[model samples]
Target: MTRDATSFDALYKAEPDPWNYETSAYEAEKYRRCLALLPRCRYPRGLEIGCSIGVMSAEIAQRCDSLLALDFAQTAVARARARGIPNARFEVATIPAEWPAGRWDLIVLSEVLYYLGPAELDRTVTLVAKSLAAGGCCLVAGYTGPTETTLSALDVQDRLLHGLAEAHPRHAIYKDRDASWIAAIFECRTCPAGG
Candidate 1:
């Protein structure tokens, strides 16, 4: 079965922060790398999918004027909203089903892709490609490889459409090796004249 938004809802229902934001070394370094590699220094509106308990959202909040952090479970949403994370607006919503209309300057899919199967992931990539504003960038990273749990590494999975390359003919990919796992960066396609 594909890991849809429901998979995360059930996951978050069991634990508000399934990834252990406060104590996990892996999550800390991953968020650090994500922010440093961003194409822009500032974004007006950002979107973070599968925000869990909003740890990553708090970090992302530093770079954007406003952030829309989303999780599938109400339990996660309640805690995320209560975290009083700066410049953040928390909402409980499912992926693809509850995506905001128009465009975004930044989108973070950190560690959330593995739960989804190929088809849904492809649809997500399509959405990412279309939803991005001109010159905007989307950062897609996941737990590099498999774990004892249901998590699948974004590195090994072919389910996601974009190849794990920092610089494709159309875009770029940079894989950073950390103590725990590798973080991959995928930039969007640039147009002829500019962004």
Candidate 2:
């Protein structure tokens, strides 16, 4: 089953930085590598899923004209909003259910997809493919470590790639993997100039 919002809310209530997003050297490196994997230097519109407290959102916002960051937990959203990222907006939202309307030039899924059940994961893949602009890109970063969630990171990646293949034609432009994590970028081929 997908991890529910209440659990995440409780986690944030108990610890503002449950994942140590701000101070962890590992996470810092992961963010750097993930950002480096993006195909383009800038995106006009970007969406970040599961942006817990805007740590990564802050980095992503630097490369986007406008960024909308979402988290399932309201407490997390509040913290993210407090970051005061001028070009980024933080909102409380549950994925595969309450996605925002409109296409995005960049979509980021960072260490979050493995929490979803099979059905929800499939729905999210469809949403991502359909909402991505013709020349947009999707960046997926996952923890390769063992987990108690509905899917493993590698499993989520495989399912996402397969589902995307069925929904749209995209190029897997970049990929990086190590013992602890994996990251990849998929870019749409039909984008017009400057898209």
Candidate 3:
């Protein structure tokens, strides 16, 4: 079973910025590079899951016309909202459950997918295909490792993601340094909505 929203709540109850993405230089640099890869920086609509505190969402807001940033924890969502991303909407939502309506020009699963189980991952890939705008890109980035914690893990997300790539198409991947991290970009095939 994937760790449910309640577990994430417990995490936020412990620390508001658990990973320290806002203050950590390493995380800030990573976000900088993540934003740098946008083939079309001016995307019409962008969606990101696990948008802790919205630092990256703020960065993405600069590149896209509108963005929907989500996290399972209310505190995280609230903090992200306070960041004041006028063009971005912050919601407390869990993936593949509250998958947003309307096609997305860019979908990001930054540092979050690993928490989901295989079943959730499979469902999420399908949701990504359905939600993608024609020629839209999906970026999945997370900590790749054998850590004791769940969800923060990354490695095999690439396999699950790639196995579905043939059906989705426009697939491309880029990994950060091998030190327990990886990031990739994928584009879904032309769906009816996108077409």
Top model number, lDDT: 2
Per-residue lDDT tens digits for candidate 3, residues 1-195, read 456777778887799888887899888888877766666658899999889788889988888899999988888888899988789999988887888899888888887877777777778877877777777777777776665544454544665476547566655555444466677777554554535
C-alpha TM-score for every candidate: 0.80, 0.95, 0.87
Candidate 2 residue 8 Cα shift, in angstroms, is: 0.7
Position 75, candidate 1: lDDT: 74
Query: Model 2, residue 101: displacement in angstroms?
Result: 0.8
lDDT per residue as tens, model 1, 99-172? 77877878888777766655656667667667776556677676655464344664333444354222224665
Clashes of each: 7, 0, 2
The 0-to-1 C-alpha lDDT of every candidate, in the order given, reads 0.71, 0.89, 0.76
Ranking by TM-score: 2, 3, 1
Pairs that collide, model 3: 114-151, 115-151
Model 1's C-alpha root-mean-square deviation from the true structure amounts to 3.5
Deviation of model 2 at 145, angstroms: 0.9
Off by over 4 Å in 2: 193-195
